[model samples]
Target: MTITLYNTATRSKQPLEPIEDGKVSMYVCGPTVYDRAHIGNARAVVVFDMLYRLLRHEYGAESVTYVRNFTDVDDKINARAAEEGRPISEITEETTQWFLDDMAAIGALEPNEMPRATAYVPHMVKMIEGLIEKGHAYAAEGHVLFKVRSYADYGKLSGRSVDDMIAGARVEVAPYKEDPMDFVLWKPSDADTPGWDSPWGRGRPGWHIECSAMAYELLGERFDIHGGGNDLTFPHHENEIAQSKCAGHDFANIWMHNEMLQVEGKKMSKSLGNFFTVRDLLDQGVPGEVIRFVMLSTHYRKPMDWTEQKRVEAEKTLVGWYWMTEDAATGEVPAALIDALRSDLNVSKALMEMHLMAKNGDAAGLLSSMTLLGFPAVNQNLSPSLLEKVQRTNAAPDMLDSNSDLQLFQKKLESLRADALVSKDFSALDDLKGKLGAAGVEVRMTKEGVTLSPGPFFAIENLEVLK
Candidate 1:
């Protein structure tokens, strides 16, 4: 089945047909390097990371080219530099590194290309010059602004009229603007501000222009998909669409946006005393995989209510899945789960199906299925030392034996069986039955019929009666 994505531009789930056969070019808006990325910001990263993983899994890894850009030369970064009394470059570098570290800790894969606005200044200048030459943009005073009226399709992406944008924009209307709707393509930098000498002036590119330039330079004019948080749907992405289309390029074919993340039913903010960084979540003992599971529990386009209970629930669910597959003697996952993932990355549905498979005693099928969902069953490769530690912590006195190998294997198997029960996998019961029977164990199928015991291994006494 072909993969379908919810395109923000069309407001529909469209089939993801690549421009070039077997290859997909995707760009996700990256963080502005001024402060640590909060959990809201991390949601976008994780959402896109999942998309990237899904795409790579469906297509070959080499077929996907992912680009996420850093807005290093933004007003926010400049303000941060001033606040800290440091050079803007230094501040940008420091903050960018911190952002990378935070994202990595949460298991986000590095993009194929990570471009910084500071490194793409020349490209931005060329694009601005092209816009000016095409009469799509103009230079006024020490600033250059894109003429909103010039692009009749300005509101196509954002659905916001130029008049509405101008009225709502909180920034003071500069006297040099030809129209209030005209957004800055370039602006003059003062002696202390970071700037690059261009045909317009010694100033930096505007926030919107930087993305347009970087995207064009890296992915060409018409790419497959451009993605980011829903908050960027307005002026930012709208401006990019206008600038790129007017620059005589087709630009992106699909625009995908993930919804905002809220904390405890409220918008995550410092004033609410609920603002959280990914680091904060980690420091609070939230597992990285748990964070990922929680983020993916809801569809990407739906706003996620991140509460502590939700996180705890996600962890419990993940631990259960791990336990089910970890116990199979053959250690094979079910194929049904893998098939579910191939259908549209329906992770929630896949998980539900896994429960059904477990109930049906499909151990191999369950293991195979969960593996396709990127949840591999635990195996013997767990470090011996770690296993020893686990044994020391959780082993019952009766479970200890002088033989290290037997003790470790038995303990691991028992833990796996316990986990399977917790995950509601009844297939594990049969495995336990077989193992106990082979070890000369006798099982009485009593009125309750829920327990097993060791008896004469080779004796087949009252087999029919036991059933």
Candidate 2:
């Protein structure tokens, strides 16, 4: 299947044709290791991870080259170290591992190569010297700045003109800068700070230079796809393009950027009192799988809003799916399922297809599709006894007292629901439902019947009165 992706560079959906027939290469801008990855960051993590999986699906697994960099040498890391009275290496190393653990919890695949910025300092220096030689950059007071206007297409990725950018006034105007729009490529570092000796002087590479250098070093001059959050489309990606193209490298052919995430219909901000980290949600007992499901519920190109309602729905759906596929062996993922994912990571559509498969009693198909979507798969078909034991563990403990007790509660609730429909007086029904809800049992009412799926807080003893 020819995988089609939405390219921010072209502003169009284009089919991916790898430079090498069977090999695929992709570079995603990874995190700067200073703090825990927030939900906003998780969106980009899952987005590129989905693309990485899809690329491997279309191209053979071994033929794919995925590189995600670790920005270990950022000012934020330095500041965090100084503020906490710890070594900068300790901060970067700890936060980098935290990033990996959290993303892995949410089902992100590790990239084929994870190169740290500190390791690529020499490569960055070489690239900067070339940019200087090509007249795309210049040295000013021990600092190297990219000549933005020197490359006519500097703002092409962000679709902003240089004149407009200058008029807008976001550029950092420094006495060392020849133009307000000139961005730093290399900045001087003192003895106290992390420093590398270079042609310019003792200095470190700029933020934008890290990805450009790492991508070139790992994936070569040109690669298949480059991805990150929409926030990076501007100065970050735009500068990377200018410098890479100016250095005479082909660079990434397809530029893909996922839109930013939101919380409850608003931009997640600490000032707004809605900021949350991935670890926070996990600590609150939301399964990592559920978080991954909620992320996929919305299309990658659209802004995903994380809500409590979505979390509950995801939990309910996943529990049902896991139970349904308990004894099923792995089957081939449906072709239609793959088509939905291939069409620009249309995850919501793929989710719909998986639901249809489940409803049709295609347990094997359902399991396969879930795994393809990055959900965990059961390595072996679970035995009936083991499945029941697992279900009891997740269900409210009080309700699973005995077989007779289980039947009694289900029969009682089913009777109450039936009466509530006919009497049109759901006062009793509502009360029982509320009681069940309190015990961590979700009450789903359909035209055909009432279904009770135990939630994380379920308790069986609460239903003793029904007996």
Best by lDDT: 2
Candidate 2: misplaced stretches above 4 Å?
A: 378-390, 393-467
Off by over 4 Å in 1: 166-171, 327-345, 354-467
TM-score for each prediction?
0.77, 0.83
Best by TM-score: 2
lDDT of residue 107 for candidate 2: 88
With a 3 Å backbone cut-off (N, CA, C), the pairs that clash in candidate 2 are: 396-458, 398-460, 398-461, 399-459, 399-460
True-vs-predicted CA distance for residue 296, candidate 2, Å: 0.7
lDDT of 2 at 225: 93
Tell me the tens digit of each residue's lDDT in model 2 across 1-467.
Answer: 66888999999999989999889999999999999999999999998888888878877789999999999998888888889999999999899999999999888999999999999999999999999998999999999999998998878899999999889876679999999999999999987689999988899999999999999999999999999999999989999999999998999999999988999999999999999999998788677888888898888989888988777767656666776676789999899989988888888878877755654568899888888788876443322333344486554322123334444556777898788779988898788777767644557877776666544323344455544
